[model samples]
Target: MTSKLTLSVFTAPSRPVNGPPAIPAPQGGWTWPPTAATLIAGEREAILVDTVPTVEDSRKLADWIEASGKELTTIYITHGHIDHYLGSSTLVDRFPRARLVATEAVARDIKTEAESGNDRDFYGQMFVDELCSTVIEPEVLADHRLELEGHDVIAVATGQSDVKDSSYIHVPDLSAVIVGDIAYNDVHPTLIGSDHESRLAWIQTLSQIQDLKPSIVVAAHRRSDATNNAEVLADTIAYLQKVDRFLPGNRLQCSSLSR
Candidate 1:
């Protein structure tokens, strides 16, 4: 008999991004959106999708996973964003046996970001003493697939959605999809570097996700109180379409895209 699969999402609370004072500071600082990290489990083994940024947050996530009493077989990153993978080293230290993996493009991007001092100099200020000292970058996922208790968990590459090399995890058995930064719920979509063309691409990707007909959809960034459901797919597409309609001839100024 095939083992039944289960899904759980851990959402981190909104934290400060520590931007310059010129930007309107809400909640005492530039509040970054909350993020979700998912865990897919079976009878004995489990797979983790994405991770938090700060060591404190990752440790909390680790404790949550430990409570499940399941073996973590793999840690899969859906994108290259720092918020999604910076705390990987913390998890790695906790679960030494679990392998960290991502697509070739995401892996390359992560390696570059890990080696570069730029991220440390930037996010370091936001997280302050909470940031992890080391980053354990993911290796290239050779097959683009992960298995938990014999169930197939496939990774779908969705070109660009807020960032390059974006992807989502499709758990067919669970009828679920964990979209990293591809869909936003109750939180404004980040379009800092996005252009009209990229917004259109993002819309197309959202539509494709709709075609997958996932019963459950997990957005990487969402309101702390929001529920995970397929409805976010349409909402994300609509948000992108609305933004695309107002694209100016020139690149969108940072001020214009501010959340």
Candidate 2:
């Protein structure tokens, strides 16, 4: 008989940014908020959703995965965000057998980010010694579906959330969707670069996620202690909807929306 699947989340707490604030925040600088990686395990093997960013954080994540005593067979990246996949090299080193995979578009975006000098400077300046300088791009997933101990783990590419070619992981067995930046849980979302069209697209994406009827929704960035409540999907949609409606009238007021 096939073994039952178990899901667990490990979160790395927010850090104080070093560079100029992306938006107005406390004088101490904005806290980056926590990012979580979900591990889905069966009796013999496991699949990891995302890896934490920094070298230190990824090492800690590796230790946590090791503690599960399950062999990691796959590392699935939900999107191209550096914060989501920057420590991929560290994970790959720790789990040499685990293959890293992502959607074709996300793979391309990741490659682009890895090669971009501006991104290097930007993230390097923001994170300083805490960031992982090594970049590793995941292989393109052929069918957008992953197999974990006879279970199907589907990856759906949503057009945009906070970035282009974004996606989420849908594990039907657990009724869980690990949304990468598509939804925020009690944390300020990054929207400084977003426009009217993009916000509408984001709302549509959230609506699509809601349609899936996932009972457990995990936000990529959230409070470390927050629960994986499905309501965060609706909450994100409402936030985006409000941004769409009010952003035009008052730029300053809308800036605070992200806060």
TM-score of each: 0.94, 0.92
Clashes of each: 0, 0
Model 2: which residue pairs collide?
none
Top candidate (TM-score) = 1
**Global fold similarity of model 2 (TM-score):** 0.92
* Per-residue lDDT over 179-241 for candidate 2, one digit per residue giving the tens place of the 0 to 100 score: 989999988777767878788888889999999898999998888788897899999988887
Worst 10 residues of 1 by lDDT: 250-259
Give me the displacement of residue 258 in model 2, in angstroms.
9.4
Off by over 4 Å in 2: 19-28, 249-259
lDDT of 2 at 2: 74
Candidate 2 has an lDDT of 0.84
